[model samples]
Target: MDDTFSPSRHGLGHSTNLVGRPSAWMASPGFNDAPVALHIWGVREMNPALFTMLDQAETLAEAGEAFLAYMVAMFGIDPEQRDAAPGSRKRFRSSFLRLIQGWGFDSNGPEGAVLKGWVESRFGILPSFHKEIIPDTQGPVWQAYVAERMQSRFHDNAILVQLDLLFEFCQWAVARFAYPGQSHLTLYRGINAVDRHGILEQQSRRAAVIRLNNLVSFSSDREVADCFGDRIITTRVPLAKVLFFPGLLPSPLLRGEREFLVLGGAFRVSIEDI
Candidate 1:
């Protein structure tokens, strides 16, 4: 129990209406309960093989290879390419570092939708943005997200599951050494409009309960985050919920930025206007 978030409310803010088996899509009942659902999906229980590799591996590079191999065997994501085929939504090959890079390219695009959808299913956190605001799990925003997620999977069949691996690995590594005694990453995110994000509860003018996009990129470097927008919000993201971090993977593509890709739920964050 990270004291930053209290279990008093027991929900993730507002729940969106999904037609079919709700558990398949949204694992937890509400905003605060999202973390509770992760109990069952702890990679050790859900995926022992991957967890073992992350635990026993000596180097990050070695762990990264085993990580990719798991995806290759499980999803048939072979013949790794750097990027998806241009305009080919029906098929894709860039699944290795796909989720992050593709997401960095366009969070509202096919890759972004898939990543967000995966978070919703696994972590029970819904996406905050997909071309527009997604207040609830119904209507055009949710429909568009579902369509985009399904379409992107045509490229790499198990890309969504592959992302699950990414999260598990990040948690394993961070646990070993995360600023010692800190379970949350001290990260910053810059946004042009805080209103556009889902502010579930307004604790104060400077702080609020914000429901973030399921898979969101944040910067460990405050100055770098400031470059993205005029308003800045900094928060403590639980290490268990982090998906990707700088140097977590050996790929050169991730070397350029001090960014951490965090799985989002409703967070009590402090806002500062630059």
Candidate 2:
């Protein structure tokens, strides 16, 4: 959420709804009603000491406004439209924070929480549901696990995109290895492409299996392939997680042509190009 994004450079025009025009790899359906990967419980859940920092003299409405502003500062949601309505900011707080706590199907904090139980039941990681099993050291594997879980969860309801992660890693590789200052990370996926969302079953699934098999092809990773191999890469950082640590990923990892993105399907390290 870096506020440093130049509008002309980043292409975030004066658009309010981001439902249609996401990065090419993302596609429209993914943004429309995609799965919620990681939803923080609340503004209070953001920092343990946040509630203590609030001002008692301020009205709850003003307090909520400030809270959302603080969140906007943290997440860096673009100021696409001016926030001008009287109670709009507070309403943002009530809705966004409330949705964070209530809407996400899974989460990574606290015992007896709604998201925690959902994660447990969905992934079959029961009994120790609240335990922090995703280790910091196992960064790649932890991320892959999350992505796979997201795919499984949204299989019936959402259009998942693993493409952005690949693009990010590719850009990372180019910036890290190609040229230090010549970091060209802008990989644009247009907004016109479309894909199917309806489930493929019966003869269709078999036909899909045959058609996909027929279209399959492979090539060696010569230097040229290594230069732009994001098409083959699939690891990705979740959007929710990326908001917190914007610069943790270096570009070098993305450019490597090996199948390093998916390590045993338990871990993944992918990047979006843009």
Candidate 3:
């Protein structure tokens, strides 16, 4: 596990070395107000050996199978604890599986919090919401627990690693269907918070710098995105920015058409009509 972001970071007075760059050097000089960051780590720096196994797979299904297999192999859960019989929940999922499940229940719930923490640790994109707006990272509100929530709950979780594999697999699948001329996929997200509070900067009437949550759901269908909000925010997401999408997993877990899990950062976006 990467100790760069430990649960005891605040308490232990430890330094957190962010993996992703937040300065928006990728943006042009005029669009520098909004710091755009893609949630990714260098393959060579963290785990070069991991993708060597991916070199053998040819098809999407095969890649998915390989992804699941690699995830299970990497799960460090105790064998006896893992094999324990399911009681009330029908078929009980392992600790790692619950993080994904938790995301379904509510994006502001415990699972969502942990997943956001994982994104922050790995991608350096801080979460913009907790129960409410995380206005300031240095404020008293943030110091209360920080990310100890991730460390305290389910001490035996490999969900972060599982999500990492899931992201890599999604990235691979996105590349498989890459069009010859296209560099980005148009993704839409409907948002309600257009006020002074949530937005990082109100640069213009149509365009503003908004800080999205570390991990967020978006739609490829404009109608679906419109259904969620009074205002629609459309972003031309590069294939690399997509973390996960529907149909990527054979399991019914990610069921839906044109839905996506996108990595978040400060993005200057135009608000479109709903």
Estimate, for each residue in 1-274, the C-alpha lDDT of model 2 and write its tens digit.
Answer: 0001111122211232122222222212232124233222232343434344334314433433444454446444333212223223432321122212222222332211322223232222211112222323235634544454443322321111112222232233333333235411211111110111111122331121000100011112333333433322222222321211112222121122221111011112122231
Arrange candidates, best lDDT first. Answer: 1, 3, 2
Q: Residue 3 lDDT in model 3?
A: 7
Score candidate 2 by lDDT.
0.24
Writing each residue's lDDT as its tens digit, candidate 3 over 17-88 gives 234453233322222333333435553246555566666777667766666666666665333332243232
Ranking by TM-score: 1, 3, 2
Q: Which candidate number maximizes TM-score? A: 1
For model 1, the stretches where C-alpha displacement exceeds 4 angstroms are 1-49, 73-76, 79-96, 152-156, 177-181
* lDDT over C-alpha atoms for residue 95 of model 3: 53
- Runs in model 3 deviating more than 4 A are 1-53, 76-96, 138-140, 143-148, 177-182, 200-204
* Cα distance off (Å), candidate 1, residue 56: 3.5
Q: Which tens-of-lDDT digit does each residue in 144-245 have in candidate 1?
A: 878988883444565655665666666666666444355556688887767656566888989987766556778888989788888888887766566677
Q: After best superposition, candidate 2 residue 256: deviation in angstroms?
A: 49
Give the C-alpha miss distance for residue 183 in model 1, angstroms.
0.7
TM-score of each: 0.75, 0.19, 0.72
